[model samples]
Target: MIPSLSEATIRHHTIAQSFERGQGYYRAGSVHSLIQRGDRLLARVEGSEATDYQINVYFDQGGITRATCTCPYDYEGWCKHIVAVLLTCLNQPDRIEHRPALATLLASLNREQLETIVQNIANEQPEWMDAVEVQIALLTQSKTQKSQKAPRRTTVDPKPIERQVKRIINRYVEQWNDEPALDEIREIIQKADKFLEQGDGNNALIILGAIVRAYVQDWMNLDGSSGESGAFFEELDDALTEAILSAELTTSEFQQWQKELKNWQKEVVDYGVDSFEMSLTALQQGWEYPPLQEVLQGNITELGAWEDEAPDFADDLAWIRLKILERQGRHQEYLYLAEAEGQTDRYLQMLTKLGRSQEAIALAEQEMSTAGEAWTLAKTLRQQGELKSALNIAMQGLSLGGSNHYGLAVWASELAEGIDLEIAFQTRLKAFQLQPSLPDYLKLKELAGHRWDSLQPELLDTLRQSSSSLHAKAKAAIFLEEGLIEDAIATVTQLSSYESDIIHPVMDAAIAHRPDWVIENARPRAESIINAAQAQYYHHALNWLRRVRAAYLQLGQQEEWHRHRTALMQTHTRKHKLVAMLQQRDLT
Candidate 1:
């Protein structure tokens, strides 16, 4: 069941513009084909692109665990499409069709019904039979041809995949301006990712190898010098490495792959792609390594075996082993390898997952080094109904001298609520001290309550003396939030860059209280943009000039403002779009 979500929760997760746009999308009935598969919500949203974006929102008793969309709107959090689906779930729950989990649904259906369903699906698309046939074989095929550890091989031809990669590369060869049209190649990789995710490693290997062998043979035909093609290879490297690690192989088969990849590695180095180096390392260290085997056998304390800063592939290799173990339900071995590899985050998490809270709590003291490690275990502990220990671990992690994550501290602060309000205040205060932002400032002020008056001066002083390396937005916002007009003015002025973002708010708020400051700052910043003639940022420049106009009007100096505006127009007479846009957007 999807948790009952609120409008406030939706707004909190996404930006204000996205929230408003999502509301519009929902009202316009853009959210379609809404369905509930167990605790997962699926929907298609009609968007600007011709194809509708698909969205999946997962939830449980706690809340919406995660939401994802097919749309390429990767900024900070959930995109407008995801927001619209959540909004629909919140308001129009009746529009959703709930179904049992896929496994349960299949179990309930009779064999004849399932056969009819597959037959109907194949009839809908005749070409799908090629895939359907391969799947059927995999399901019913006996293990007589190979060892039980090896993955079932697909009878699907590699010719079609190779041809697709060639077609995509040749089609986009002429348009190699900045970046090639590698979205199709990326699509091929995504197809392989599905097989790898489902543990069908050999089939994934076939798909990945087809794309790589074809693309590498022809990628140099385009403009590979621009360094854009390197990203494509990097993605290929990750998928290929995962394929290599996931697929169970005989010793002879491993050496054969290593030989092939070595040649491919040599060819790719000239293109400025180093990602394949890790893939090569992975092939060389495939699970038979002695020390790794020792760790898998629960000999964690025996660190004298292989004790150097692990090769760069150590983390990724360890993760693959841990995942394989996890999938096989070998949790104890997972713990052993995780601890031996110094994956404190995973080690403590498994302890919590196994309901050994006392073990987790006790081990956290020695095992938790970074704030990230502590946060992972703390979050797991809190989810499993261990509130006191969660808060304790969160505080311990934050107070650790090495490093701390500001976002986790804020989350920890939220978890601390109803348990110990003072600890919550302290946790939030630590977040602000770590990284001051306007939101954190407001939160701290609100939480301070009666103590705010006493806390205000020190906080303001700290911001004033803060390192210039701190985010400009954070500095400007904190100062403006407190109505410290002079402090806000100084915050923007101290920065080396034309702090227009900081200045825009400062000038708006200071037009009445400090008109002189607004005029002094706005004209130069606006002129710099106009002189550069970038055209895109003209509106931003005009925005600052409007504040200047307002400041002049406030001081009864409209005539001076008019002369300055006229001089600017006279100087840049050739920029017609700039002039027209300025007049149109109320710059007159």
Candidate 2:
């Protein structure tokens, strides 16, 4: 909020207030002048070398003001330019005292001044002049003698940090996009390629690093020319990282890969891990692409001799060995590693999954009281038919995390199967209020799935009065139960643009009813719509063409099936061409 100020003090107090409020917006040039109009302050600050900022500060009579800047930050609210203006008003430009004490001022003079004053005085008296001259000569001789004896200072050249960085990247580029530097990167790439060939991510890090280094290097320069490259790199990097980080690679070779990964220069990204981890995540899904997968899995098993490796490789290799054991269902050996690493959560989850719920819950609850852990415990207890314990776990989770209402509702619904509909509905409603997704809605419907439990009139009214779209979905669900397919379809279709998923269930139900009269009437109408408005319904028409192909095959209509298949093939070709163009753009 801006405060109102008069024309006279517009530049002074108003700008001061802006700075005091921490508005540090600045432009290329300093503030030139300021003026005031009707309830507004106009400030002219020099912008870039070629432009200037003409700002307008609108103020209200009650001492409220808002400034609009011409700079880009103005669009974002509060910028450095505003701060500059405020600084100008504070009147502390040089931040030095205007005056000084006599002794302090005299002390500031250099040795040259002291020498000059003494020499001038000495020249007025013959005896003093001679003495001063002798002293001056001695001083000059001493300076010269000292200067001649001192060793010459040599200047070391500034470290070429930027140039070194560039060279490193250029070499990396040559290695990945052109050649390989150390045998390690090449070996890794080869291993990754082989892994990709086999569709195994046993050596994900190596392949991920190669690709990440390639792309991250390309865009780090930040010149606008690399914008598209940067975007593509970011997307690929994110997907690849996700896949690698999520997949637990548990082999001696994979352990070596981890050891090699630690050698990479550590960098921090958006997530909780370092740059290597970030890169690993960013490129995880990239392995799904066949070409990339090939590049990723080129040299997996060829990595040799871990026993005589660097010290950093030991822990990583050991972890991989443990992961392998876990994958083989060798829980005892895996537990050895977990104990060594102090991984309580891993121990708990494994125990819970292995039907040791009581021990797992006790252990997890001792160290942590998290909703996710509690929820998992509840699920395990429920599965083991410990209703009382499961309910207690659910309550604990709800108390800890306000958002666990859905988990509570789930437990309630399960417990109330044949007992009380009202309790189930109430619990579900609480969850729905907190976070309403499809599953929650489905749970509510399921509570009413078996018997027509008359919802209290108020609850029914409340459902009807809720969101129009949700209400439509509820109505459609009711109609679906009554076997009124058309009505269900109609209710869902009312919000067709928004409720695409709702339509799927309704369509599934409607399509199940193939009464002769209804099918005959609807089939021709759909055909007429497709034929008369083909361009308008191109996507839908394509779907209809597919259905026709299937239906004709069922009816032994070979000619019709052939025609539909040909159309679909043509559409497929066109789609492929567009995809090819997009891929080409990525390479460039």
Candidate 1 backbone collisions, by pair = none
Residue 370, model 1: lDDT of 84
lDDT string for model 1 (85-168, tens) is: 988888888999988888888998899999999899989999999898868766775544222344586544668999998887
lDDT of 2 by residue, 339-454 (tens): 44444445565676677878876776675456665666666665565555555666566656534556555554445433455655566666655544334454565555544256
Error in Å for residue 19 of model 2: 64
Per-model tally of clashing residue pairs:
0, 47
List candidate 1 stretches off by more than 4 Å: 1-73, 78-153, 159-187, 218-235, 250-256, 299-310, 467-469, 494-499, 533-540, 553-559, 576-585
Query: Model 1: which ten-residue window has the lowest total lDDT?
Result: 141-150
lDDT for each of the candidates? 0.77, 0.46
Best by lDDT: 1
Angstrom error of the Cα, residue 206, model 2: value is 4.0
